[model samples]
Target: MAEVVGPRLYSCCHCRNHVALHDDVISKAFQGRHGRAFLFSHALNIMVGPKEDRQLMTGLHTVADVDCSDCRGVLGWKYERANEETQKYKEGKFILENLNIVKENW
Candidate 1:
């Protein structure tokens, strides 16, 4: 018989709650409020806060903070809308800070 392996995941650093999958990572070259961050196509076990417009390095964007549902720790933000056409690709995507997430199932 063969053993089963689960998907690689990223979890909240403070609570170890599964947040995003490694396979969902879109880009590792992103900047967060604290430091380096990763762009993910999807995230789990997270709650999106109220949307607000903020000025980021890329441009003005409407974003919402993403929090860990279990611990309510701020993980990152989700891009709700992008003002720049060149940055439109970020809309509907999520950013998970490297400082706030840990690798799991690897």
Candidate 2:
């Protein structure tokens, strides 16, 4: 019989709390505060902090910090609103730093 397999996931590096599913990944070419980041369609086990406008490489956008609910460690930010029409597609997306997350069940 074929072995059972579970959904692939990304976990918080600090506390091993599952944060995102591999299927939810939108893009992996995003830039984060530290370095490489990934844009995810959805995130789990996280908390969204206060929203504020910040100027990013693409343009000005309102975003909220995302933290791990279990460890309270800052994972990245979520785009609340995009100022430019071309960047509007990024709104409501979550960016998680590569350094802050580890792959699980790969």
lDDT of 1 by residue, 33-65 (tens): 999999999999999999999999988999999
Deviating ranges (above 4 Å) for candidate 2: 1-4
What are the models' TM-scores? Answer: 0.95, 0.95
lDDT of 1: 0.97
Candidate 1 Cα errors over 4 Å, as ranges: 1-4
Q: In candidate 1, what residue range of length 10 has the lowest lDDT sum?
A: 1-10
| Residue pairs in candidate 2 whose N, alpha carbon or C atoms collide under 3 angstroms | none
Cα lDDT listed for each candidate: 0.97, 0.97
